[model samples]
Target: MWKFSIRRILIMIPQIILLSILIFMMAKMMPGDALSGLIDPNIDPATIEERREALGLNDPWHIQYADWVGGAITGDLGQSFRFKMDVTDIVGQRIVNTFWLSLATLIFTYLIAIPLGITSGRYNDSWLDQSITGYTYLGFATPLFIFALVMLWIFGFHFGWFPTSGSVSPGLEPGTVDYVISKIYHLILPALSLALITTVNTVQYLRSEIIDTKQKDFIITARSKGASESRVYNSHILRNSLLPIAAFFGFEITGLIGGTIFVEQIFGYPGMGQLFLESIMIRDYTVVTAVVLLFGIASILGALLSDIILSLVDPRIRIK
Candidate 1:
């Protein structure tokens, strides 16, 4: 397993390098560089040039990229031309906010998915099964942002139940309790929006796997032994069915990060997505590169973790 893990790490090297290069090139090629955000209409050209030189923006692309990569390695991450602070520092503050949103979405997806998946699995052609299947399809078809809008219209504009936007109600003080509660409140719309896209996808996959398992020789034998249907499912099917889903846990997390790019806007949630967009608009290449790198690291780490967890749960598929 250790040998396999080392191999995996080695394989990841090129991927990381490729992403680094891609991020560098894209950041550079985007219309207007960092200085575009800083230049004032009334500023003298020489002063602008001097400011550009001061920020090392006058350097050739290769020189700039080399310096950027070096700073990234040392955790310095350079300064955001837009925010005028260390890019890492800016992202660090936002990481907690993003983490909260992502975590809530993850927990909620599973909480609803697991039970519905199990139920759908247990009753193959029953009314309950068909109803769940239809519901899941509805979720799958709806775009997440559109779903968020629908939710906003129903629960926010019409009913006036929850706060429509932002992480919390205005003027609320921040702290551990308030912080957590604020997140929970803000998490609802985006979570549902994102979860809607996934619940059907996940539950349907799980249901199909479960139904397949029901036909297995072992399951039949267990049923012949007069085991209750629920017993057969709990003792035999759920864990095995969950294994495949478990393998994609990391990917799901990464997907949530990607999805946040749009969902964050509809909800006005503070997270990496909003940060990335704002940085891109200002051509804050340093900040853009930092967040993208962080996201890449997160995805690779998630894949690595899913592998480890899957191996632990199912002995048949060793990491080696």
Candidate 2:
């Protein structure tokens, strides 16, 4: 297992390099340079050109890419043109916010999905199963942004039940119990929105897996061995059924990140997703490339995590 993990990490080195190169080149293809955001209407063209030269934006793409990569290797992600701070510092703050939000979303996703999936599978074609199926369909069909807006409107605006934007309420002293409560309170709407949308796939996949696994010969054999229904279902059917869900976990990470962008924007949440969108709009190449590269690394890591989880959940499967 350790050898397999090491090999996967080694493979990730080239994958990350390729991903970084692709992100850099794509950022270069944007219509304007990072200085576009800094350029003032009254500023002299020569002054702008001098600023470009100072920032090394005047260099060839390969040179710029090389410089950026070299800097990134040493943990310097360059300065954000708009924020006027190190990109690492900026991303560090936002990634923390995103992490909490993503964590909440993941928890909510499984909490909602697993039980419904199990029930639906256990009672296939019954009223309860049909109800869950309809719910999942609705969740899958609704656009995340629209759901966020509606939630913001009804729960945040109309009812004033939850904060509409930001990770925490303003003026709360950090480190206090109230501050922690405010953080969780502010997270509920957006996290729930993403969870509702994201769980559609998980519920459907798990439900199908469970249903399929129930018909397997092992489940029948377990039943014939005089095992209790609960034992047979839990030990034989549900355990094996989870294999596909384990595999799906990696893809779920990417999906959550993608959904986060729209949800964060809608909620005005301070996270990488919101930052990525804002950076692109202003052509903050430093932040854009950094965020994209981080996202790429996250995707690769998530896949690795899924593989480890898959192996752990089913002892029959070996990494080697």
Candidate 3:
């Protein structure tokens, strides 16, 4: 297992390097340099050239990429052109916000998906399963942005049950209980928006897996042995059915990070997603490239984690 993990990590090095080269070239292909955001089109040519030189944008693409990669190894992601601040610092702050939002969404996802899926699968062709299927169809059909808007209106604007946007209420003292309550309140709608779709998707996958697993020879053998139906389902069926679900958990987390962008934007939440959108609008190459690289690295790490988890859950996977 350890050897497998080490091998995977070794493989990731080249994948990440190739990813960086692709992203760097894509960023270079974009219409303007970082300084374009800061300088007016009417600015004197010599002035722009000097500014570009000062910022080292005058260097060749390979040189700049090498410098960026070297700095990244030292935990420096470079400064954002738009924010005029360290990329690490800016992204770090947003990561905390995104973490909380994603955490809440994840909790909601599993809490809802597990029971709903199990029940729906166990009761296949029954009214209960039919109802769950119908509900999930709605979740699958609704676009995320549309869902966000409907939620913002129903909960935030109309009912006043939850705050529509932002991480917390303005002027609340940060450490107090009230502040915590307010933060959670603000999070409810956006988190629900993200979690609803994920839950529905998870439920569908789990339901399918459960149905398949329940038909396996082992499940039939357990039934024939006169094990109680509940024990057969719970002790054997659920455990085996959840293996594939467990394997995908890491990838789901990375997907949540990417999904958070749209949710955060709609909710006016200050997270990496919002930062990424703003950075793109401003053509902040350093920030854009950094975020893209972050996403790529995260994806590779997620895949690695998923493989490890699969091996742990089913030792047969480790042998393979």
Candidate 4:
């Protein structure tokens, strides 16, 4: 397991480099650079050129990429042209906010999904199973934006149970307990918006896996040996069913992170998703690249973690 983990980590290095290159190239292909935002009939051409030069935007693409890479190695992501602040600091704050949101969503998803899936699997073909299946299908079919809008209207605007926008209420002291509680309170709606869709996926996947695993020869043998239904499912079936699910958890997490972009925007939450959306509108190349690279890194890391989990859970994965 240790050897396999080490090998995966080493292999990820080049993959990460390639990912960064792709993101950088894509950012370069955007219609304009930071100077695009500065365009105005009144602004002097020479002034624009001078500012571009100062930003090294006048440099050849290779030189600019090299400089960006160097800065990145030292943990400097670059400067946000729009915010006029260190890209790291600006994005860092948003990352923290998104991290908390994502974490909460994940916890909520699993907490709800696990028991529901197990129950559905245990009672396959029953009304409860049918109802859960139907719900998940509708969830999977509906667009996230529409679901978010409906949820926002119902919970935020109608019931008035949660804040409609922002990470927290305005004017709360940053370090106080009330501040932390306010942050969580505001997050409930957005987090639910993210989690509900994912929960359906999780339940469906887990339930199907469990149902299939229960039909296996070993599971039948366990049941024939007079093991209680709970023991047969929990001690035998559940563990085996989890292997495939664990293998995909990394990509699952990456998808959730990506989903946050639109979900955060809908909720008006101050997370990486919102920051990225605003940056693109303003053509802040530095901020865009930084956020894209951050997402890529997160995806790679999630895959790595998933691989480690698979190795731990299923010895055959490590053996292979």
Which digits, one per residue and each the tens of the lDDT, describe model 2 over residues 1-320? Answer: 66666777787789988998899899888888767776684789889889999989989999999998999889899888788889999998999999999999999999999999999998999999999999999997898898889989999899998888899878999899999999999898999989988998889988999899889988888888899999988888888787678766877887788989999999999999999999888778879889999898999888777777766666566554
Q: Kindly report which residue stretches of model 4 are placed more than 4 angstroms away from their true locations once superposed.
A: 38-42
The per-prediction CA RMSD against the true structure, in angstroms, equals: 2.3, 2.0, 1.7, 1.9
lDDT digits (tens) for residues 1-320 of candidate 1:
66666777787788888888888898887787767766684779899889889989889988998988888899898777677788788988888778877887888888888788889988989999999999998887787778878887898789987777777766777776876687687778777767767667778988999999889999989999999977888889887798888887877887887878777777777778888888777667778878998898888878777776666667567664
Give the Cα-based TM-score of candidate 4 against the true structure: 0.94
Candidate 4, residue 72: the lDDT equals 92
Alpha-carbon error at 130 in model 4, in Å? 0.4
> Against the true structure, what is each candidate's TM-score?
0.90, 0.93, 0.94, 0.94
Q: Name the 10 consecutive residues with the lowest summed lDDT in model 2.
A: 311-320
Model 4 pairs in collision: none
Q: What is the lDDT of residue 16 in candidate 4?
A: 89
- Measured by TM-score, the strongest candidate is 3
lDDT of 4 by residue, 11-43 (tens): 899998899889888888888876675557368
Cα lDDT, all candidates: 0.81, 0.88, 0.88, 0.86
Runs of candidate 3 with Cα error greater than 4 angstroms are 318-320
